[model samples]
Target: MKKENSMKRALVSVSDKTNLVPFVKGLEEHGYEIVSTGGTKKALDEAGIKTISIEDVTHFPEILDGRVKTLNPYVHGGLLARRDLPEHMKTLEDLSITPIDLVCVNLYPFKETILKSGVELADAIENIDIGGPSMVRSAAKNYQSVTIVTDINDYDQVLTEIEENGDTTAETKAKLGAKAFRTTAAYDALISQYLTAQVGLEDPEKLTLTYDLKETMRYGENSHQRAWLYEDALPKSFSILEAEQLHGKKLSYNNIKDADEALRCVREFDEPTVVAMKHMNPCGIGRGDSLEVAWDRAYEADSVSIFGGVIALNRKVDLATAEKMRKIFLEIIVAPGFDDDAFAVLAKKKNIRLLQVDFDQKDEPTKDEVVSVMGGLLMQDQDTLKEDCHDWEVVTDVKPTEDQLKAMMFAWKAVKHAKSNAIVVANNERTLGVGEGQPNRIDSLKIAVKHAGDLVEGSVLASDAFFPFDDCVKYAGEHGVKAIVQPGGSVRDQDSIDMANKLGIAMVTTGVRHFRH
Candidate 1:
């Protein structure tokens, strides 16, 4: 007699049972016996569709709270046996195992489970499905004989092909097998990363990264290079990927990079602030009591560079701010929110992208920043440290006044976002000039002072790193800079200090460097 019946036998186990009942009913219509376990069987039986319990096939009761149900050899033997091999068929017949032609399995919701707020460790561990992945891998390995279905979206296609051909074609089986393997791989990578973080394991022997494709960009930094954007599987709250784009054309590769830079810089200020960025560098950063004032100050900081640059605001965009922005040509505007009239005014500029990012959400304490190099990858912790002016030490005889100290802090925050070797000249709340990505610190200083021009006098300066020589300090003093802050670690730190005291300029040592590369 034929094993089971003169028809196909399918094993189905899934956490997501969407469209499962109808699909199984269709299979039964085509003379296939449905075998299921746990919730799947209950749902099928409730829908008036007959299902053979897994115990009937394995001859073993599910133990350990349904964990050991489908891991039995009877289940694996049927799914993994090659119908083309005579010995495999004889062994199945001797063991009385019915050959399983189809295996439809999707793993537990591990990613969703761990993402829950205050989820217990035991709960997350329990949600890690062991039997499901085993079945998927086994069936995928024997794709020549067993068809695997892991995605719910593929139900219609698979069912249509089976209806037309009486069985899934070999080509369809191979494609489904490849998709199943990819699903399991991504699932395992997420689990590995979560467990690694729980154990505080740094630099594991194997590094696996999983990301979902968010967008396919028109091009990369250059028009000739093809590019795509991938968001982190568990994205941060304050991310460009999380932002809602209200208006404008699709974002290009350079637009995303510049918008990211603008967001990072704007986050450094809690007050009403605006950050202007171009080509992944800050053109100007401004802070004021109101959003409109902040926009004016930021625009005044670098009116020339502000053209065709990204603008990020920490406060809601009002009609006043929107009116001021409408006068210039900006590539993008990002804010916490935009008022009705403000959005209507700005939306008229069809080419300008409008992004509303939520600033109320808190970010994780730490995140891994990854950069890909030729044939290798580099990973490091993102620089999110908040510097306190109280921790800084004054090294010069000329003491900075309270106003000057505040200006130095403002400059520090601006310089942190600029590229190295970076320098920022600012008064109290607005950046007068920014110079970055120069070969030498003095050259950066010269560029900044030139940008400042008449405004250089009575302004405070901040550097990302210590002065290698006393020349930068001497140059700043001659240019009439009132105060300076740098990570004082150089061997010639005293020389810079002596120069500051000689020129009656106040100098502060932060003992920390903020280098952005």
Candidate 2:
């Protein structure tokens, strides 16, 4: 075995030869022997740097399409043998093998190949590195003595430490070892994920998901719970998670959850829209020609419920809208962008969190919604269904007018965003009142009607689900609700139809229920 005091040997093999030429030169300056594979040795020689090939170290030529080079026992023994243990040192000493102090390597371009369009299976298979990961793992396992460097970004740090202090620190070795293991794990995960996608596995019995930690929170919903924010390994599109905080305190767990709901609701409208949320339920929603008008009407929809709520807008926030939003003590405000003056004004308040997300980067609505349970996860298709007036059947003898149908359609969009057992009273493309998360449909109706006050006379009512009995229709009639829209699949549908006709109310069945729970 080679003496540690005199000189050390380093094995350098990398598919990503980012800084290898200069790095290998540095090793030679410090009296270290560099051993590398075919291309690395050739490149080092071409660069006027001395490097011994693996064939010279193992006394065997690289064969079997170059797969048989570093898998030999001479290389493995040099890497795996412990210098501190007498038996391990004797094994290497008897075999005339030297101990490897450093292993600098990165995996094959498997990830790059998979990213290319129309890449062949044989190409992907050939790019999978066998000896590289094996050597990296071997060196990382002996981190007490062997330093494993996987990333090119770490090259300068390693070189600086070696130039200053003859050897790399044990702490750096441990950190680099951890990064090596993680890199291999991520590599295998990508391969598995890509193959699983190709085979069209809708729902595999075993599900594996990868996420990278983005932030560590002080606490969760309650201070007793610890929390962290992890982004998806491969994000599908823009989301609140990627939002840039322009001003105010960092978002809390509850704040992010409610903000997500608000943003998703506002994305449903193509016009200038505003949605205010509390506890993940939208309290106020409005659409108008301008964002200022939308913000005004949405806040007025339920002024009491919007306090300390999260706000989301689909359009750029102008100065007029920003000033109006600052009137209330809000937890968050999210939009695509803000006017310079508006942003300056909003920045005055330090506690309210402000975020900007791009409107063009919105995701497709039909993706899966995943819910985590005690021991597993549940996934289902997202509710992207839209109600068409042409598909609706007007059950009452008095049919809804064109304007009334338009109002009902607007109300349907809002009702879909509300929780189950919802009732929304909207007119002129704005919600006047909303009742959601109630135990019974009657209570929801009463709450919605009561909130509307006298405005319920000409407003159209929308229910997320069908009316089980005629009582809701009777109450809507008594309250002077002119039009009612609901999904008509109940066994007693005729009862509500009869009540609607008798009360001279126009009722329509959309055939599509918007139950959001």
Candidate 3:
């Protein structure tokens, strides 16, 4: 039933046409027949490369507007048949099917389609490739007898092997098979994520997620532990990974973590702002009319704590700000952009990493925040909800002045980013002190008051959660705090309210808690 000395067959179908002509030409040079479908076949024909159409092989017209073209048994049987097994060869011979020795397939542009501006749901659904994944999985499953090519980067490797060894090696086929399965898995995960969001399914029965390996870090949080960075499949436009590294050595794990915290804190302000981050906590935050003024306020807030911290700015870095920053040792500086003179001044320090993140991109949508536990994972919606000062309820007898209310909101924003059991002491436009991650609220308040020192006289106070007891309020009063802002959810909220009134401290309840752990 088999034709004597027939050429090997390579089934090729891909949405990305990168290097398709040259790769197919090399396969032809190796005495392989090119089998393609739809747009791929037309492209091959235009490139003057001969190709056998899927319709010709299946002996059926492509129905459903070309969706049903490659789903036929003829194509799968050819790809799935094993050359070494006599029964498989007999089944192929009985069905008059040629053994397809290779399969080159990449799915449609579903990710690209969904990412397009104002794309409709129907448009996204139509772009999903059904037959391509089926073919890729079949070819990958039979990798013991068939070679699978999913990545365009592997085209040369496949060609080099064919040119040198007449066939791809067993190791190469196995690796490609594993890669193909990963590709299909990631593709399916992305589709599931998109559809789940479209249907407003908050908690899906099965949680499927995918990420791309962005970098292999030198180490994890510690030097002995190994770690790598995996970026989201659809990364947010405002993420640190989107930033261009203007100068300095590669970012360390700590550098990235601190820089991310700084960026998140700085984005909370609309005016020119600066945030200084150490570990994962903001040591200082400042907003001003000019970038230089903001830098001065942030630096003067806690000059000692910000010595080796990461700095994030919402505006472009100017020469004056750069000169001030050059005086201190900083791990990284992240900003929207940097002037030429500013860059030169900062680049003078060989070890500081400078990152330029675009501030003009559209606002990012809220995403799920996932944390890994020992045996399970915790998932929650990201806290991207903007808080309005007018929504706050005044719970105390003493009403806050406009300046004190502004300071309360400023401290509230800063405290939201700090770890739980956090406290922030701030003026109208700058954070004087911050304390977080304490075992008790009073202890955190004490640390914040001590950090603020003499500057705590007229500054307002913000707590991530309600006061468990009146002790925190009394301590804030003793420190000369002018006003307090908190979520006010505890059963003893009245006690804290009573204490605030006794101390003549204005208190506002946000009715919303921001707990970062």
Go through the candidates in order and give the C-alpha RMSD of each one to the true structure. Answer: 2.7, 4.1, 2.5
Candidate 1 local lDDT, 1-517, one digit each (tens): 1123358999999999999988988788877899999999999999998899999999999999987899989999998999999999999999899999998888899999999999999999999999999999999999998989999999998888777777888999999999889888989999999999899999899998899889888889899999999998888878788899999998889999899889988888888999999888888888999999999899888999999999999999999999999989999999999999999999999899999998986354546889899999999988778888877999999988999988999999999999999999999979998999998999999989988889999999999999999999999989989899999999999999999999999999999999998
Which tens-of-lDDT digit does each residue in 359-462 have in candidate 2?
78775433467788999778887777655776799888998999999889888888888898999998965788899999999999998988888889988999
Candidate 1 least-lDDT 10 residues? 1-10
Model 3, global lDDT: 0.91
Rank the candidate models, highest TM-score first: 3, 1, 2
Q: Give the TM-score of candidate 3.
A: 0.97
The TM-score of candidate 2 is 0.83
- Structural similarity to truth (TM-score) of each candidate: 0.96, 0.83, 0.97
When 2 and 3 are scored with lDDT, the better candidate is: 3
Q: Of the pair 1 and 2, which is ahead by lDDT?
A: 1
Give the clash total for candidate 3: 0
Q: How many residue pairs clash in each candidate?
A: 0, 0, 0
Kindly report which residue stretches of model 1 are placed more than 4 angstroms away from their true locations once superposed: 1-6
What lDDT would candidate 1 get against the real structure? 0.91
